[model samples]
Target: MGLESNSMPKIVIGDFGYTLEDVPHLSDFIPDLPTYPNPLQDNPAYSAVRQYFVDYDDTIAQNIVVHKDTPRGIHFRRAGPRQRVYFESDDVHACIVTCGGLCPGLNTVIREIVCSLNYMYGVKSVLGIHGGYKGFYSKNTISLTPKSVNDIHKRGGTILGTSRGGYETKKIVDSIQDRGINQVYIIGGDGTQKGAAVIFEEIKKRGLKVAVVGIPKTIDNDIPVIDKSFGFDTAVEEAERAINAAHVEATSFENGIGLVKLMGRYSGFIAMYATIASRDVDCCLIPESPFYLEGRGGLFEYIEKRLKEFGHMVIVIAEGAGQEMLSESLNQKDASGNKLLQDVGLWISQKIKDHFSKERKMTINLKYIDPTYMIRAIPSSASDNVYCTLLAQSAVHGAMAGYTGFTVGPVNGRYAYIPFHRINERQNKVVITDRMWARLLSSTSQPSFLSTKDVVEDSMDDKKETPNYALLENGFADAHK
Candidate 1:
């Protein structure tokens, strides 16, 4: 008896099973999925995995209904009618895992999925794929039961565990297929999501109908349309809290500057949003704007003046802020004679305070603080409660609607689906729109302390006299101005 289209798998919050519609294989859904060059056609790792896949296929592929198609999520198909159910006591199973840098509210996502899926549709066989994609192939999985996952709602890190690496191999797909893992939920940023797509393609080729769901998990909150990634709010709150504490210190001393850096690889959402949300920040440096170049001294000078006038300064910088504003007095270096660039937040603070102290002969004390791991991993604030739960519920809804190969991003404040593979497409870093830039420039009369024209330049031969303010008045440098 095949799963009839009319009989959708009924799913209620307290019910016993999820609603699944037809799911197709790659050739049926999107024929253009990249066919990888089978590097290890018969390697032991590949063989073992492939065998596992085929064995499972043999066990459930025929007469099993949901077992014969590809794991392309909810992509449309033109082939014969697809299997319409996800959890067949004989086949369907679910899983999740975390990977890469930590972000806030990870546990909430895991807890919601486990509880909802278990209670709603009896999709009780939820496994945690340990160590990201690597754990998938290594097959090091930890099972998550309703009981085990109950109290995880208030947790911070991923309870499912995570890894950072995996290989693109048929064997890996086959192993998963053999395990009856019909669906997988991955929580991570671009890299991990891209890996999920790769695995989806591989299993699709073999015609095992598995669904792959990706949750955009990054503290950077740079992923498009998601209206703030899972951990961004938490990270920003923590950063602001730290900045406020630093502000108190700066004010108490009546003559100090605090430079702080938040994480965002090539984006400025964290730095920009935190600065706007938390009013204590005097200046914010983001990858969207030039940091360590010439013409970038204005902000530093402006902050210095503020400290001199108002008694304290707080500057928020992105980790990827270019290495331009280093002062000649502070000795900074990396192993390669590169401008020693860790703790960029601190570097900016030091450079600005140093400029005023060295030039004005004022005792402008400085403290450089980089809350790299701290901000990212802080327990999510109360504000995250609503958003985190909503996002996790959204993923579940997307799955129930038979949607796949799409990312659920926030649009006009509502979560909407975007082409899923775009998660890895790497949208260009957010450029400061001319209008926004003008508003920022006009909003305050604070002139830039450092020029934007110069980046960090350290004399490789000598260690002293680092970070000089080179006047670089140009388009890129205009960000600071």
Candidate 2:
């Protein structure tokens, strides 16, 4: 409870095309030796990754109460001397890996590193850590090459695959020590970041030379000060695609409600942004605003009002919108002091259906979840591409310059690499929503949803924008037409 500081670290950020004289190169996950390598469908590592870190069948529901008390906070390990040094010697090799959930632009990040290390800088011993940290210890190797990363800029999912359970054991920690891996780039979400910190702590504890650089890789945009995660734009673009498409369907059907959910548990940025970008979303629910029954009435009543006003409405629900009503997540234990993730998307949909059924006294048939996976991986959005590349470049630069305990984030729409010198420092952390983005979503019409100001009065500061209607001069103009 005594971690406090107020200065951002000035780490060196290696450039994509520019190289420094004193900078050290990172490792490539691909092994120098390649054999008839194939994958096992039931690789033991796969089980651990899905079960321990990234499983979809984990029976989640929209519960709001669980989101309070302990918010979704990521704990970073204080870096000593391991994750700071660069792998300059042949004895040391560096590789990038993704663990747990699939990020939108894993390929962008990995591609940037591969390009920078091999083409820009002199370091070319980079390897691809297949299946995440487990691959670091696995007997297999995925060496980097011009052929290996060819056309990866537009690909989705990790070519190396990912796992979540690799960091929970001593053997995994020792495997890095044995293999002489100097550093590992971990590109993943909260769970993977946690694993990165744990691995860093263990690697340093074992006196290993490997560095672990954790690039914020969630489409959820929940990570700090980076403003938005690498894949968030890609996911939002995909969501916008789906939402806009659904609007077409809603129009063609003449009288139907289309609901699509996005992947933001503790933040509504995705839901809000996607809605803003598209021309179909009628309402959006995010974690920052909890649902109320009595004072704010029910979501159904609001929907009914929208129906009365617009005949049909499209709703964009953030997955984490219902954290206030649910119990704490099992992962965030009783003593851990972390709140649970709420799934209000599903709840809001259900509540609408229930309300419609009662009000009309008829079975309400509606479409809600259009969860398209790997939207983060599609590599279509320019913002995501730029963001991923900046992160990779900054990561390499930060390492060569000796920066630790920090995550590279996007600041002012550019990669402003931030180091966590203080555990409880809020300045280094990215604010979820700024006035600029809020002003973008203030319109009552168009794709983005509008809510009663009183319902989210407490969060108004975070919601207000500088008001730039020029970009959306014709907000929801299509809807009226």
Top candidate (TM-score) = 1
lDDT of 1 by residue, 1-481 (tens): 1111121222212122221222322335444433322223323544565222111111111111244453422211111111232334324487777876677788888887777566543466888877766776787888888788777766666676655544544665776887877667778777666666666666655666566667777777666534567777778777777787777767777587776777776677777767766677777767666544223345545665686678877777787666444443335543212233455655555556566677667786676677878876566777776666766655654454344544444443554444444456553354564454334434433333343323323333344654564323342422211
Q: RMSD, model 1, all Cα superposed?
A: 14.8
Q: In candidate 2, what are the lDDT values of residues 148-254, reduced to their tens digit? A: 79779787887888765534346666766677666677787665555565665555555554566778766666655445666777787788877876666655553
Native-referenced Cα lDDT, model 2: 0.55
Off by over 4 Å in 2: 1-92, 253-255, 293-297, 323-347, 362-365, 374-377, 402-405, 413-417, 420-441, 445-481
The reply for model 1, stretches above 4 Å from the true place, is: 1-90, 169-171, 291-297, 324-341, 357-359, 428-430, 434-445, 448-481
lDDT of 2 at 373: 69
